[model samples]
Target: MIEFEFVKPSTVADAVKALAADGAQALSGGQTLTPTMKQRLATPSVLVSLNGIAEMKGVTVGGGVVTIGGATTHATVAKEASAYPALARLAGGIGDPAVRNRGTIGGSIANNDPAACYPAGALASGAVIVTNKRSITADDFFKGMFATVLDEGEIITSVSFPVPLKAAYVKFDQPASRFALTGVFVAQYAGGVRVAVTGASNNGVFRWKEAEAALSANFSASAIAGLKVSPKDMISDLHGTAEYRAHLVKVLTGRAVSAA
Candidate 1:
């Protein structure tokens, strides 16, 4: 690992200021960052630890929206299943207990891994990413593989998601890593329906417009009957072929709609 300085800020303002310094990177749960550092992929001059900021941790649901603090761990969400069952299910499905205890929503979304489940949930729920500067819609927050709209020194404070009338997530996990080979999140909101697919595409997270159209017409599993996703756009890895992952997208989407 590369040698680096560490700064633990007591507030978001302090963290942001510390991050504005040269070669600074925010450390939330360190689930992805730590590994990247260990592999010599990220060699920051300073690590701004957000754990010291009390404002960046917790979950709040009210007025038809759910706001999750940046530092809120998956274990907290899983343990408080009664608040949001679907969210609890999503959190519980993240990884083993150790990972769930440390990995955070902010870290996951900021990293925006192609196979991460939180992105799917955010997209499907029409979540807004609240950063130190401005709020970014999920559609604009995620750019591509391991890319996002976050600017240099910008910090994600929290994420606010509109509560869907009904929603559910389904994923086909790789047995060894528990990473989603293909996962789908289906949601029926007031304006319309949204279906976000993760793990199957090179684009990281994308909306299944065809499936959303079908579900909007009729919110039912059978509604996805004629929806066919082209494998041309999906990612092909050792876990599954592009065609296989595409098939799973439709299948899991149907299951999610049914479960919702």
Candidate 2:
């Protein structure tokens, strides 16, 4: 790991200020950040640890919504989000015990890993990303693989996800890293149904509009019959081919809807 200064701030304001300094980067659970740093892929001059800020960790629910602190660990979400069993399941299955204990929801989404589970749940559940500057809708927050709309030095304070009538997340894990090769999250809300596909797309996590429309009309696994995901926009690698991922998307979507 590259030599770097570490700063632990007691408040969000202090952390934000520290991050504004030259070559500064934010650190939550250090799951992704730590590994990248050790690989010398990320070498910030200073590391601002958000774990010292008590305000950035916890979970709360109100008005049919689940509000989670940005620094809240995956284990916390798995234990707290009992109201949304599927979400809790997703959190519980993120990584092994170590990764789940250290990885934060903010860290996962902010890093915007294409195979991450939180983004699927956040997007499918119609969550809002609360930042120091402003609230960004899930649709606008995730830009692409390992990317987001977060501005320089901006701190994500929390995320608020609306309670869905029914929801389920299904993932095809790659075994080693346990990252999804292709995953699907299905949700039914008062407004309509939502289908968010992750891990398969080359661009990033995205809504399956065709499946959404079909499922919204008939809320069931069989409703997505004949619906197909194009392989042209999917990722092709050793773990899985574009055609394989596309097939998994449809299969996972059906399973998720059935489970939901």
Winning candidate number (lDDT): 2
Name the lDDT value of residue 172 in candidate 1: 96
lDDT of model 1 at position 205: 96
State each model's CA lDDT, in order: 0.90, 0.92
Q: Candidate 1, clashing residue pairs?
A: none
TM-score, candidate 2, is: 0.99
Lowest lDDT sum, 10 consecutive residues, model 2, at 220-229
Candidate 1: tens digits of C-alpha lDDT, residues 67-108: 889998999877754455677789899988999999999999
Residue-level lDDT for 166 in candidate 2: 93
Report how far residue 81 has shifted in candidate 1, in Å.
Answer: 6.1
Candidate 2 per-residue lDDT, tens place, 1-260, comes to 98999999999999989999999999989999999999999999999998988898998989988899999999999999887788889999998988999999998889889999999999898899999889999999999888899998888889999989999999999999899999999999988999999999988899999999998899988988888788998999999999999999999999999888
Model 1: how far is 50 from its true place, Å?
0.8
